[model samples]
Target: MNDRLLALKLFSRAGRVGNFSSAGRELGLSQPSASRLIAALEADVGAALFSRTTRAVTLTDAGATYLMRVEAILAALDEADHEARGTGELRGVVRVGTPISFALREIIPRLPAFMKQHPALKIELRVTDRYPDLVTEGIDVSIQFGALPDSSATARKLIRQPRILTASPDYLRERGTPAMPSDLAHHVVIISPAHPSPTFSFRKDGRVVSVRVDGQLAITINEGAIASAVVGLGIAASSESSARAELEAGELVRVLPDWDVGSMEVTAVFVSGKTIKPAARAFTDFLATELRN
Candidate 1:
């Protein structure tokens, strides 16, 4: 609870949570004390740590850079403490970014078990559809879906789920199910921004076919696309995980049972560079295993 250590801890937590008040509460400090400490730390460093608005607090450019180094230091301290205590349990916070749908459907449901195993560790799970700037966002790791083209960061493929075309039972009854992939051209398709364009590819019996379809509705979120499809919007592309419940409830029916729309891959991108903290590494391993099951 020394001033310097307290400031570093507060700054790191604030940077991760994007809230001074919440971060302060976690550390058992009052909001006023947390603000004063951050201000003093910024003055000491000769830079503003956060840009404040009435609604939210975001890290400044300098703050983001400083957080990376500060987190490294904190992680090292956590490691030293673990060694000194002779316990293998992880400590400290590991910020993770995940797509909203997967986080809700797969990860969050299984998180309690993981937390039970490592009670000392903290997970800051950020849920969003957009591919985030990991370093700037202070994300230790990011669980992402689809293809990641940027080769700048370290990535590991966790699972690849088959993507399929699906439509609501009502929609199928009204528009008639397409007998062939080619027939999709005549039907309404729901475009997902996750895909590069309205073009979709299918594979059957060693023959690969690509089809370009148009839609009145375009959705960025996978869950939104599935929800739209559930309500009879149009034929939509969805992964098994995102649409499992609806598919089970008969709200959505497969458009073409035999054909495959390739597959969607979920990848874990680590932002801690060459050396990753133990807590972050453990969380990533847990996710990789749990997601596969």
Candidate 2:
């Protein structure tokens, strides 16, 4: 790659990951070299692109804006290269953001087939439980679950995952199954305090009831909470898909099956300002089809 182009690539990656040394490793450069290259790029542009502190390296206001434009330029270059290749294949790297539990249960298992289909494409799968900033991370697309807040990003629904409440047979047998939604107040529940769902709503035959749950055990991760519930911890909130295999193996049983916990939607999210690269678009389409089936 051209020197300037390589620096720009490093800048973009570092800006999203919030680290230079890690980004340098990805691009096969040392920390000192990464710093020197970025410094040169800053001098060329006549502005400091990142604000460095002992604890963190963050983009300055101007740097953030410039990143948008530089990324656009790079994306366009990628598109031009693909068109010129004349092989009728999707070529280029696509960075994807996803929650870990979803990726493990749904996405990763299906990746082999997708990769075989687009052998020229490269994927960088970044996982986190929290919602990622699409623009900052340069994520081509993300798979998000639950309700989407009003935002600048555009989203397309892939599938509506029906959420469920589950408990191990041992736990249910010990505590006795709750007959009513309100009865949950008397039972020990598993919850993730980090997430904003302190309240859970259940609906049955046009009747809706919301319950505030408190638990002795708290697991911040969704997968951990589900796993905790498996060992007879307490009732847990889970998506049907995530709990599928466990449910089939008779380790978990649906609680209050007559009532519904509503749907947690699975969606493909894209930042509004950028063009969806052909490879990214194809990946999202493939994910949607697989999820629907």
Candidate 3:
């Protein structure tokens, strides 16, 4: 039997007031229950822990000796609990930088649940349509879509989403569908200004094709581009995960099913040479699991 925990609490409380009733009240246990726990502790140690009378109680010599060690042990346990809670409970500010579209559609919905898991934590989310230098921006974590190129910061792929070239059914019916990647030149393309230097590489039936396509309809934002494409304005390429609902709802159709339009490897990038904050690390892990599912 482990007498340490029961004895420790019993001894600490008893030592504090030198009375069983007061100790029992402080520890939220009945006097009889507390006394029995201390009595059992005395049996385990083979020593009389307390001198009791109808009127009052006092510590025995053994109890006095045990009291010092119990106090130190309890103090250490409390300090350890505080440190563990500081890490696990996530009670600090975590600055997160992310793309606007993703922040709006994906991460925000799950924010409440994550906050619930760490009630004491405060999250400051910065949503930008442009990439920011994580170190300069003082961001703990950055969620970015597309390939991270020539970045000095450390990053890990959180999710891999395949890009698919899609067009509205009305657009396809009126302008005619592309028979091949080369045929895209004959169709009107709606390009997202969000990606200024967009180029695509596709593989179809073991044959690779690269295209540097330009479009007539250029928009400054992704939501507007997606909206325009759905209204049959032109064709555009986007991550399949983002376009899944639209495609499933018959708002858009895949332009080329056999060819892969290239995959966007969304990554969690952090500042170089810095330990990721506990909150940021926890959030990143949660995102990775969510995207995988």
Question: What TM-scores do the predictions have?
Answer: 0.79, 0.85, 0.67
lDDT of 3 by residue, 108-183 (tens): 9888889998898889898886787664355779988876754777898898877777889999999998888878
Tens-place lDDT digits, model 1, residues 167-199: 999999998999888888888898874464778
Tens digit per residue, CA lDDT, model 2, 160-265: 8888888999999999998998888888788752234667888988988998877777777788877888999988887888888889999999999989888788
Off by over 4 Å in 2: 14-23, 39-66, 86-88, 135-138, 193-196
Q: Give the TM-score of candidate 2.
A: 0.85
Candidate with the greatest TM-score versus the true structure: 2
Q: Quantify all predictions' global Cα lDDT against the true fold.
A: 0.85, 0.85, 0.76
Error of 1 at 9 (Å): 4.4
| lDDT-superior candidate, 1 or 3 | 1
Clashing pairs in 1: none
TM-score of 3: 0.67
Q: Which residue window of length 10 is worst by lDDT in model 1? A: 271-280
Question: Given candidate 1, what's the lDDT at residue 102?
Answer: 89
Q: How many residue-pair clashes does candidate 3 contain? A: 0
